[model samples]
Target chain A: MFRLLIEKELREIIGSTKFAVSFGVCSILILLAFYLGAANYLASVAQYNAARAENLRQLEGLTDWLAVRDYRIFLPPRPLTTLVSGIANDVGRTIEINGRGDLVAHDSRYGDEPIYAIFRFLDLDFVFQIVLSLFAIVFAYDSINGEKERGTLRLTFANAVPKAHYILAKLIGSYAALAVPLLIPLALGSLLLVVMGIPLSSNEWMRLGVIIATGIAYVGVFLTLSILLSSLTQRSSTSFLMLLVIWVMSVIIVPRGAVLLAGRAVSVPTIEENNAKKGKLNAQLWREDREAMTKFQPSSSSDPQRMASEFQKLMQEMADKRDARMKQLSDRLNEERTNAQQVQRGLAFGIARVSPAATFALATTALAGTSLDLEYLFRDAALAYQQAYAGFMFKKTGVNLSRGMIIMRTESGDPEKPKSINANELPVFTYSERGVSEVMQAVLPDIGLLLLYNVLFFAGAFVAFLRYDLR
Target chain B: MESGQPVFEAIGLTKKYEDETLALDHVSFSVRAGEIFAMLGGNGAGKTTTINLFLNFIEPTEGEARINGIASHKDPLTAKRNVAFVSENVMLYPNFTALQNLDYFSRLGGKTQYSKENYHAVLRRVGLQEEAHTKRLRGFSKGMRQKCGIAIAILKDAPAILLDEPTSGLDPQAGFEFIELLRSLRDDGKSILMSTHDIFRAKEVADVVGIMNRGKLIMQKHAAELAGHDLEELYMKYIAGHIRDAA
Candidate 1:
């Protein structure tokens, strides 16, 4: 009996042209998005590489062949970036530094180019949140009420099968149909990535699997909600329209509204304010250090050349102190900026909870390591790298390059070595992979919310259907 | 038809709509096995209400109906299995062809393996042409659809058949043919309960005629017992007297 019912359902759904048309539309949309994503990633990669090559050329002109130890150029994205595309391009620097400092400025040349930041490739996170959930709503909104409108429900329920079994069968069947198209395309995309020689480790595979599973679960939650609404309503058109409204609210309207609300709530400090404090601290430190250097200058002029050399060394030391003080001020400003941003993002995330779309986006971005959180981490790593490079150069070189380099070590081997630094001593930019437990912890609340929606919808649908009159 | 038993019994069945209109008030009737019973009533005479009580389409406000000695409200499927229903204009899947419709309904009643040959034989028994078998019902005439419906009832082979105004929209020729079909089925020992306003047809075919007025069974008599009186006159007299007394 159940087999016959399933066959009947399959037949009816296939006979309708709407199902075929919808499936076709979804497939085309996904294919288009895939091509677009690949194109955008390639374009960005090309631009970043070209710019980095140019920056490296400029750096070579600044440092002599043997004195290249004063600088280390951080080049563009590696090939693996195209697959996950992570946060590498967003916070990366083309210009590198080997100088004397406790902290170093970001790629000075690129910081002025704000246009690059806006046009960066949006990652896989964008695809699942916006496209997959809409498809889910379309698949499930007509599951029940459409049958009722066609007057098939009476015959379907006239059989000895329970209504609960019937609803479950529909959910299972539609979910399978919806998930199949997405899975095949996603698998093909992954294959293309591999064929293009983007490296993926076993750990990356595990992470990707979880990300896909979470995506399916998120879609399942919405599908169940649509089904529940369809069951509760009398007309299929009304149910479908209601579902469309929900999709718009969750996917488009609510997230932006939440961000706006968060912005207004805590008042994110402007970059101008942040930079003003850094400038003020640098000036104060410079003035105090210069006064100290004047006091330390020798009063006697008997040994005039020695006094001049000693005064030069004293000025160099004082310059180093001023640089250290400026670095401290900059670090504090960055820390404050981070704290303010964190508070705003937290408020935004809280407000965005009204929409499942926001939850799915947050979870997927975190899993892919393409989130703003990941950007912050990368920024800290880059800053630390810059500081370490500067420390190595200052300690190893005899010349203070603060007043601009005066041709130190004219003849040397391995010109690219960090000035005044051991080549093998500094720490590499080794980012630790996020553990599964940590990933789960980060997304557990989202998973809980989705499950909550799933349960609530099924429960409401069950109760509503139990009372429905088949005739 | 089984002997020594009432196949249908209505014990003061009553139905009141939310508007407080008494659709069926203290209506009661019974049919013994092998009896061809005809319910004759004017429009709004509670004929459909009585039939719905038997079919359990809606719950009764008071009392109950039984089919094959089983309470219809207590066990709907059990009662419905013992009976087959044919409305004035039966609703079927318009998308399906006539043969497919028969096959679907047969399968719904837990019957399978109703082959093409069997379906053709049944259609021929009901006098529907074989050429009309595969055509969709979109363009079917009322009489043709009626024949197809009779084919379905014959295919079902239920012990008791309940029909509502089976000849309402039929031409006189089709109506005569329908009566003939009923007679043949009755000869085969099938018990039938039909509701109609056709007095002459009832006189010609029915073994027992029951007239209802204002939700009440006003008159019931064996056709043989009223052999001398005109059924038309008897029907008019019953309706006129009942309405006059109520006024």
Candidate 2:
């Protein structure tokens, strides 16, 4: 009976030209995203490879006595990256491995560029949260109310079937229809990833499976909501209107509203404040050290050779003190950013999590390794590598290293005049894809929210339906 | 089942809308098995409400309504399965052909494997032309829709059938032909309760006739008991003289 009902529902959905048109639009959007992502991925790969080749060529030109140390890192994109495109490819370096604070520096790069990243990505996250959710509303919004309009509900209930079975069958049937269009496109997209040479390990496959399950759960949430709304509204058109309002609130209004509220509650200091604070702390350290040296100089003996030796020792000590102060200032600035970021992420998640759409989006991104968390990891790694390279330059050559000028020569390279550094020495930025057990832990809250929504709506519908004036 | 047990029964059935407009009030009536019962009344007579109660489409505010010995509301599915109904407008799926509509409805009633041959037989019984069965209801006339509706009732083979103004839009000759068909259904032992304004049609075919006013069964008598009396005159007498007294 359930199978038959599912078939009927699928036929009804597919039979409508509206479903066909919307499906076509969705397919086109997905295809476009896939092409665009693939193009960007290819472009980035080419850029990094070219950079590597330049470094290699420079190494080849150097003399044997001169060792070329490289500090470039390379992290390959996983096969499922195309589906969720999580912060994996966008936030971290392709390759970087110089002897530096790998963990601390990786935190600063936080993915490559937010602008180029998905503000509204077209992966499973987008499909489940935005597209499938809409489809669910369309499918289930009119489930009972439409029958009432057509005078079919009375006719249907006039048979020998329990009302609960009837309503359950309707939900199950509509959900199946909703899932097919989403699953097909996603499966095809994953296959495309394989074709593009992204390796999918067993664990990644498990993560993908969870992503699909989450999608279904999210759809169930929307389906139940629509059913409940339909039961409450007398007219089909009114029900549809109410559902539209809910969708807009959940998908658009909630996330943005939360951001607005968070912004108002706590004003994050501007980048200028961050830089200025850093400057002030560094200056304070230098001032104290200068005073200490001045006192030392005044008391020193006037013997020519002894005075020269003391002057050299004092200069070296001053440099070390300057480095330590700079480190303290940088640490303070980073800590401030981390605190602000934590508050912002907390507010965003708290507000957006109310919406099933946003819940699905966050879950899918986490599964795909393209979330803000991964982006932050990449930034931290890059920052640490930079600091290590700066320290090396300061100690070995006495050259003050700027952020961009720090480079290394790889081993087995020429000895002299190698302008470009070896790519091999760069630290490779790798994204640690969360395992199934870990993903389940990460997404439990979202799952709970979605399930809570489902239960709430279904319960409302059941209560309302039991007392409904069937006439 | 027994002589005293009615095939359809309602006792003090009452309903009021949420805003408290009394649509049906303290209404009660019953029909015996295999009998043709006609409910005759003027506009706003609560005839439709009474029919709805029997079908369990709406719950009665007080008292009880039953079909074939089962309380309609308590066991609506079983009660409704034993009954068929044709409303005045006969709204159907306009997107489906008449045959498809019939097949769809039959399946809803738990009848599958409804071949075209079986549908044509029922359609023929309802006096519908074979060619009209393939046409969508979008182009159907009131009379045509009513015919298709009767065909559905016949296909269900329900123990009792209810028709709301079955001859309202038909020509006099067509109306006569339709009632004649109802007479044959009666012979086939299907109890029928029809609400109609056609007193002459009732005089011609009904075994028992009832006059309702303001949700009360004002008068009920066997057609044979009023055999010599003019039905139209008796109907006018009740319409003009009995409503206030019945209330």
Candidate 3:
């Protein structure tokens, strides 16, 4: 009996023109997102290689390591970022490591290319969040009430069909009918990835698989919610209107609204304010250092080279002292701001998770390693690389390269040509992505929330259907 | 299983909506095997409410509606297994062909053993043309859709059938053909309970006739007893609250 009901439902939906149109649109969007993501990733890779080569080209012909200036490290793009995108494009990718001061990332993709930021990339996350979820609503918003309006519900229930079996069959049949066809586009998209030579490691492949699974689960939440609303209302038109309002709230409003509300509740210092505080301390330290530099006296009967070396050592000491003081103030201010931001983030995401769409976005972004945390991860990695570069510079030049040092070359009439410094010896910067295990741990909660939404809505639909008035 | 055993029974079945409207009040009636009981009434006269109780579409406010000795509300799945229903509009799946709709409803009615030929034969039995059998019902007319509905009931082969205002929208020819189909089903020993406002059609085909008004079953009689009496006049008097005990 259950099988018969499910078969009828499948036939009823699959044979409709509505299904045909929705399926066609979804397939095209999914394939387009895959194609565009692959193309975008390729473009980013080419740009990154060119920029790195230019950085190296500029470093050629330098006679001393201390003269190396404007040496920049770039955050490499990952293949998954082209699909999920989260905050990857908004955060700065380039960090100029001066080897002494705070390493601030610069040259964000969106900052450089404002047009792309105007309408963001059409990625897999957008396709699933905006398009597929709406398709789910389109397919299921009239599942129950439409039958009643058509007078089929009474006729169907006139037999021995149990309400439980009928509702369950409706959910399973609709999901199967819609979700199974979606896999074709997804499989083709994955094949596109392989053909386009976007090399995804095994860990990345698993994350992608989970991301697709979460997308399907997100679709299920809308499907079951539509069915629930249909069962609760009397007329199909009324149910459809209610479902549209709910879709708007869940997809468009809730996530952003929660963030705005959290913003009002939590107060964090602005970047300019923190920068002003650090600048005040730096000015005070510079005044004191200058007074000390003015009091320096040369040694009696000193050789010219010896006097120059003594002056250099004194300057290095004063510079190191000022740097240590600035670092102390900067770390304190950054930590205070970071603590407040974390609080705001926790509260905002907690409330935003009420919508399954938000949960799905969170889970997929975490899997892709392009989440909001990407900003912190990139900066931290660059800071760690700065220490390595600073240590290497000290070994070669006998002074920190980032200490505002001025090298003077007073050449005699017949000075031999100095050998050029090797640019290849500079420490390479590699941005390490989060491990699969750690990403899975971060995504697990959101995945659970999505599943919970599915189960709760299905249960609501089931209960509503059981008490539904077929007459 | 006896010839006169009741296949559908309503013992003091009553229904009251949440808005305090008494839809059905202390209504009691039975449809025996091989019997055609036509319930005659106007709008809001509780005719459809009784049928709803029998189908277990809604729970009774007071008493039991039984089908084949099973109380519908207490054990709806078991009670509904023995009954078939045809609504006023007979709206089957519009996207399905007549044969496809018949095949589906037949299986839902627990008659999965029927073959495709059986579905074609039943569609023919209900006067649906062979060409229309495979065509989608989306463009079907009222009469064609009605024929498909009756075909599903026939294919179900349940001992009891409930038809709620089944002939309300049919034209003269379609109405006459429908009456003939009902009589044939009766001849096959299927107990049928139909609710309608057609007095003459009820007089012509019904073995037993019932008239209800404002949630009360005011008049009931065998066709033999109503042979010389004017059913229309009686239905009017009963509906007007003039006669109370005309059974």
At residue A386, candidate 2 shows an lDDT of 63
Candidate 1 error regions (>4 Å): A34-139, A158-161, A180-199, A283-329, A391-437, B1-10, B14-27, B30-61, B65-67, B76-108, B115-247
Question: lDDT by residue for model 2 over A100-186, one digit each (tens)?
Answer: 322322311235455544464566666667877887888789888887776667655555656677677777777766677866766
lDDT of 1 by residue, B1-247 (tens): 4584778888898989889988888877777766788999998788878877787766789988888887777887778777767777754555567887677666655568789889888888888778888876656888888887777777767777788888998999989999999998888767788999888898899888999987888899997888999988889999999999999
Ranking by TM-score: 3, 2, 1
**lDDT of each structure?**
0.70, 0.73, 0.91
Weakest lDDT window of 10 consecutive positions for candidate 3 chain A = A400-409
Q: Which 10-residue window of candidate 1 chain A scores lowest in summed lDDT?
A: A101-110
In the predicted model 1, the residue pairs found to clash are A396-A420, A397-A420
Model 3 achieves a DockQ score of 0.90
DockQ of each: 0.20, 0.49, 0.90
lDDT of 3 by residue, A172-268 (tens): 9999988898999999999999999999999989999999999999999999999999999998899889888988998889999999999999989
Q: Which candidate's lDDT is highest? A: 3
Q: Which numbered prediction scores highest in DockQ against the true structure? A: 3
User: DockQ (C-alpha) of model 1?
Assistant: 0.20
| Tens-digit per-residue lDDT, A1-471, candidate 1 | 455455544544444455577667655655554455556456656776676455445444333232554344443343323433445555544434544432332552225466646654444555567666776777678778866765456433433355777777776666666676678766776666565554557666666777777778888878888888888888878988998898889888999999999999887667789778877887788778777866785766799878877887777777667767676777777778778888999999999987887887777666666556555555456566666655555665544444344442356677565434233444444444456678778978887787787788878877777665544
Cα error, residue B107 of model 2, in Å, equals 3.7
Model 2 TM-score (2 dp)? 0.83
Q: Write the per-residue lDDT of candidate 2 for residues B1-247, one digit (tens) a residue.
A: 6754678787888888789878777877788777889999988787888888888878888978888888887988889888887777676666567887788778767778778899988888887888998987778887888788888878777888888788898887668778888988888888889999889898889999998876767789998898899998988898888755656
Question: How high is the TM-score of chain B in model 2?
Answer: 0.93
